[model samples]
Target chain A: MDSSQRQLNRSYLLRGLTDGIPIGLVYLAVSFSIGLSARTIGMTGIQGFFMSLTTIASAGEYAGLQVMASNGTMLEMIILTVVTDIRYVLMGCAFSQRFAPNVSLLNRIGTGALITDEIFALQISKSGYIKPFYSYGAALVAVPLWAIGTYLGIIVGNIIPEFLVSALSVSLYGMFIGIIVPPARDNKAIAICIGASFILSWAAEKFLSMLSTGTRIVILIVVIASAISLLFPVADEPAKEAAQNE
Target chain B: MNRITLYIIVMAATTLLVRVIPVLLIRKEIKNRFIKSFLFYVPYVTLAVMTFPTIIECTKSPIAGAAALVGGILAALKKINMFIVAIICCVIVLVLEFVL
Candidate 1:
């Protein structure tokens, strides 16, 4: 309510927006692929746009597209989307610790809705309690680019060259590598977990070929993370601060 | 309502619930060590699981995808910013696709 409080919130918002620029750019490339897929499944541009707007999740949206392409029922759609996005629950739990205790119910709901993998990674990487406004700021930039990119991809419909599309397809993985590798380098335990995940995930894909992608991910996360935690429990401290450093 | 429209709504609601419920419920700091540790390591594991094997299938050539994977890891290990690491991987894929 006070001028100083307003100024502080504005600054957090600006910081989030600034940090979110690269994420927005990457979303443009990734969601373009999503849009292309949507079009292939016979979705209109407006439909693709609304889908991206409502579900700012790459994997979840992709799974939904596949389900629709198969004329899968609502039950199938619900199951697949929930399975694909279950990671967000873990992310949300982690983020819950990061929020300032006084963050309102409305702010919590708003910020929680925007908790994409990239944004969650950025938020937890910061050193202190997080403000809802920061998440809001990032979403303001990144979310629009995502929805618009999907719209454009549906409208543009693969007019982009094949070679360029191939190149763009790997950007999301590159960003994922960027997030995990630095932390892995710093912590031996994290590095080991990542290495194990690489091998185990590959094995899961090859051997569990019948399982859906989302199912594989959840199973792997539960097995690997739980096993590693048992072997090397993080030292006693507030989980919030530990997550901040992680 | 149209079928695709209904699907979109279902998908959006499912995704939203996964994200929103935890923050709304877990207001206090978790004190359990294993649970805390699991949460701590969740991001690294989740990101790694999502990236690998899948990344190898994303590009035109599996070889290009593998090359990009190696290049991305090396670039990221050098403490490169995310945007640069992504661009480098894309370039690696582009050139590899051209040649191979």
Candidate 2:
């Protein structure tokens, strides 16, 4: 490859790494609790590490751990995880639109494998077509930290103080706020959609408390995003041309 | 195979499938304006839906969580660096959980 093309790839990778640092840090903190839960279920630190390594999702893994704790059957585990993580399908659909058309199948598969909530948020919020190198860079930092954090959580087992854990847990939420707020501030339609999301989410939590959190989220996304899209369709843009390199 | 190992494999395979299939299948750009618009707004709505009342219940004390939520929103509105905004929210939670 030419030096100029290589340089561009490096820059996107660097941008992704920089953007991914906060996500990596938050994953470290959040996965610590998952590790602790693994320990409570009598799983070893190594097992927790592998679990986090392979399953980078927070909610799905937590639910899986609960299933293991209860000795639920494999069939039961599959159904529960599919239900819990079905949101990724929608997220993947949305994310697929951001790929430059000529990106290779391998790169697309690799990118899809790393689609956690925070990484998806970071990538989707970017202005135009995204390079696979960016997601690669972010996953480099995020994936390992997540695995190591789970390992540490199992091995360390509650050494961290309670107040500190409480504080750290909210960092993920704080990052979510940072992502949505700026865009909402810039666009009126987006602002109204987010406002409606907040109310609907809260009502679902209060009134539909029996439903799993995942189900509630899926229902809200379909309802709010569809309604908002109908009311305020984004102006169509010409199809983005494939960038020079794969 | 050990039971935990089986569980991990099953969990990982299913989760990865959910994320991978869409990207593999939807190669061409979507033409439908409504579908494109819905995809466009998915990130904002999804993130907001995940953050609300949920954020308020993430901490040891609901009050501390709520205070941090307000602090986080204000900090984010100012367009502060996301990492710094998270740190600010963490501090708010730390202080409130201590005092209350």
Best-fitting candidate, scored by DockQ: 2
Q: Please give the TM-score that candidate 1 achieves against the real structure.
A: 0.92
List TM-score per model, in order.
0.92, 0.94
**CA lDDT, every model vs. true structure:** 0.87, 0.86
lDDT of 2 by residue, A157-228 (tens): 788788888998889888888778866666788889989999999999999999998888999999999999
Off by over 4 Å in 1: A238-246
> What is the fraction of true interface contacts found in candidate 1?
0.89
lDDT of each residue in B1-100, candidate 2, tens digit only: 8899999999999999988999999888899999998887887888999999888788999999999889998998887866787889899999999999
For model 1 chain A, the run of ten residues with the poorest summed lDDT: A237-246
Fill in the DockQ of model 1.
Answer: 0.77
Off by over 4 Å in 2: A238-246
Docking band of candidate 1:
medium
